[model samples]
Target: MALSFLSHCLIGLCALSLFAWAEKECRYLPGDSGWPSIDDWSGLNDTVQGRLIATIPQASVCNSLPYGNYNSTACAELRASWTEAETYVTRPAEMMNPYYQNQSCDPFVTEKPCELGNYAVYSVNVTGQEDVLAAIRFAKEKNVRLVIKSTGHDYNGKSTGKGALSLWMHSLKTLQIIQAYESDTYSGPAVKIGPGIIAGEAYEALANVGYRIVGGECASVALAGGYTSGGGHSMLNTAYGMAADGALEWEIVTAQGEYLVATPQENADLYWALSGGGGGTYGVVLSMTTKIHPDGFISSGALQFTLAGAPNESSFWEAVRLFFEQMPSLVSDRNSLQLEIENNTFDVFGITLPDQNISAVQPLVAPYLEELTRLNISYTFTTNFSATYLDYFASIMGPLPYGPYPPTEIWNNRLVPRSVVLNSTANNLLIDAFKLAVADGTFLVGCNGINVADNEQRKHPDNAVFPAWRDAIASCSLTAFWDFDAALEVNLAVKETLVSVYTPAIEAATPGSGVYLNEIDPWYEGDWKQEMYGVNYHRLLDIKHKYDPDSLFYGHFAVGSDEFTVDGSGRLCKI
Candidate 1:
């Protein structure tokens, strides 16, 4: 805080302190003191009175992130806050929340791995918007950086900034149906949503009214940030485009401590930017008004494929080929499909509106199915009906946790096309890697989703987001789950194996293929700037100028890039 502000309000606080038996969370060093210094633990007693500290020590989650002296100073100052509070951990355990806390920390020291490179949160979980505002204001006044997190699903750990305060937004979820179009008002219905609502809540709310919105595939992903920030694709994308297209307006809290609204008509730049700009670019979103579709039950199903037990053996690779060829035929906006490959099985998912059917979809997808059958691939199809978005999202995306803590670990990811199966040459390469990775337990999880096409304003000139891929099909996500200590080696191994398997094929099949920034991989050998945003990068920079002229909202994925840092090797630097 400013000297004047500190002298005025914090003098008493500096003299007071709090003591609590050590919890896993307390072990985490705070990012900034929010005060100049502290004399003893008793000084902070009042601040942590009701707060429950964890008994276990948190594990470190990230392996590599640019770190330097600035980080050291931040941690040192933050630790001083507890010193003034006279707080000490009497019983040091291993960790806190399983979903949010790092599961793998070194046993010797309670200090977070932030010293290595990664955010070790100060305090998290504010009561509400007011609490949120207070935290932001205090951080700014204190010259402390911050990271905003709702569900903490960010693979890069961007949800938590190193040596900073994390404003956990999960409790902020409040879904209100502001306006349900009257009988005479329109051809469609729409509703207002809170910034914290998840895809499951909004989906069910709208679906109950007899309509649906293209929302998150994961039931637990936050609707406003996680879902809309990336072009939301689901079994519905073939029908509704993406979650952002349904959005009409947005309420955001910018970095400068100002609350503002962005819409297609007002603050158009910001509205466009958030649609698919990829998360963490501009400001924390408060709420959004999105259009809802006509209501009806949806029929979704899964088709399981198995290789012909050629004397107890079916060529899993050939079975996969037949599945890819089947993709083009199944492009109905009413239908969505995903193929998951694991060592044990090949799971084919097919979801469509109730009115659409397996029989109706057969012709569209028949050719590929025929190829699979020709290979003696055995298959079975199963499905059911759902009247609510919750039911549908649950059936489709399944339940990925939206957690209580800002993420403690770093997980890397990539987005790729089905070009791996486009031809014989590529197929051969992909099949080999798939077999090896699965056998070695390297390719743990593989999931795919459809992308919205260009027709629904996806090509809006103002938005420099998702690169345009005409008639684009799907994005395969290669991911790994590991502890902080194991994260570095595991994440890298999965990434390298995935790239090694596909890069050659992607190059041979679709040279200069576009990339999706939302599914970014730092090492992917593609034109990142061009493939990620296309021509939108320039216009977005321009738009960022208008909406956030002073660049107060620069920490997240803001528009302008020039102001950020760079190192001697020509690598862009991170704060």
Candidate 2:
């Protein structure tokens, strides 16, 4: 019994049966309609071969009962590692949704029911296309809200919904490598991956042979959902392109319960929307086939320095300012970098110089290093060369910082454009804003040098990725965290402050720049369509409305999401 709460579902089945007798169909409790009954749910479970799993409240916590096979000691360890990405993916309904297992439920005071907040009522642990089709059809017909989850590493709360039936794709881990994939738009080697495949799994599988693909930096990020669907950025983004740019086709089940294959030639509209349009809104993805590259060499390293003891912060700012000035030349030459600023310490990693070694990069970075030396800022710049991408990611990037369940953080990001980075006035404004954010308790600042999407290949697909991405020199983000026991108001205030201060800062620095949708605040009070998708928003809306007229699938920041609202009690209701 591998920590499964399903086997113990019998405890609630009897009560659900009583509720089934009182109701004949599934409906929203607030709509004066009956919710799904046990009988109705049983039918779905039968069709899916017992794959339906009940949402187990508090199952991931150590204090919860019905611990399955785990002992007290193991449960404690499990709780400690709840922040790890793998932990949430295994559970039925525990990802990205900050309110999960936090809201206080009425009547029940036990370890279990005391904290099942805003989680889906049930989840179909889908393993095949048929299961996805069945789940979609069931939700549409029964008037049940639907959500999709793949590894549950979402930052925008798109993977979970309240009182909904979710399709968990994490178990559908299938990876097939096509030695040569031929298509009208692209003809080359490719990999047809299940929507559930995470970055680490994909990389390990690809490295087993000799290939690489554009993907998320975090090992737990699922490639098919928020990653690729939101225009996946990678260390190789400057050299290759976004993950969406590499997408060739997708197998999805639509709101109408139709299983369709979307590619450049067929279902072209859906393909465009799925490529860079937000996930869990247009349709339910079953599998995605994307382009793959042959094994290649990359120069990678980590660099860091401290400015704490500096006579003035201006010198430190100048050192960072000089680095930004040199970004265009480095990025244009197929080089990418990620610089993390925490207080006075700067930690840089994921330094990718394609087809080059450590020796070759020394000259390019000499000017920046000289500037740092002039400021008397001691820096540690180490370099290494790897023959394969996997080796470089493993050795240079090392293990990613995965979190336990019930996360205590939220993120707000902006794609800083080249214009702002290069302009002296805008650059100073950007630095000042960052300083304000840091002073306000924003602990980490992540800046990644990325290539603009002005190349010929990016335009051909006509993707829904934000147009600003094509003009961006780097993606910048701020992370805000709070104590686990902090009040909801405190968390909300923190997020509000982050958005209020940073959004303006970023906007002033780079006017009209858009944010990376995947990492944006869920309660974003701005023009998301214009901010996230830019000119492509209208077309995305047309496709979304045409495909999901009933608003059957709605993710935060998705097209037409403004028509609905999440109330104080966490109920999603139409405005």
User: Which candidate number would show the highest lDDT if scored against the true structure?
Assistant: 2
Query: How do the predictions measure up, each by TM-score?
Result: 0.71, 0.89
Candidate 2: misplaced stretches above 4 Å? 1-27, 30-33, 58-75, 97-113, 400-408, 455-460, 485-487
**Alpha-carbon error at 63 in model 1, in Å?**
21
Best by TM-score: 2
Worst 10 residues of 2 by lDDT: 105-114
lDDT of 1 by residue, 1-575 (tens): 59988796666665453222111112123432333233322222234342212222222222122222224443444333221111111111211122223323332223443341234334444444455566556555444445666655554345544344555565556766645543321234567776556666666666666667776555555777755776666567666666666676778777666677887667777888887776666777777777776666666667776544322345566666556554644654556666667766778765465455435544555576666567666677676676654565666555423212122222223343545445666556555545555665445335454545555433333333465533456655544443433544564665565566644444444444565554444445555556666677777777666655544333323346446543332222333
Residue clash pairs of candidate 2: 26-36, 82-404, 82-405, 83-403, 83-404, 83-405, 84-403
Q: lDDT values of the candidates?
A: 0.52, 0.76
The Cα RMSD of model 2 versus the native structure comes to: 8.8
Model 1, C-alpha of 396: deviation from truth (Å): 4.9
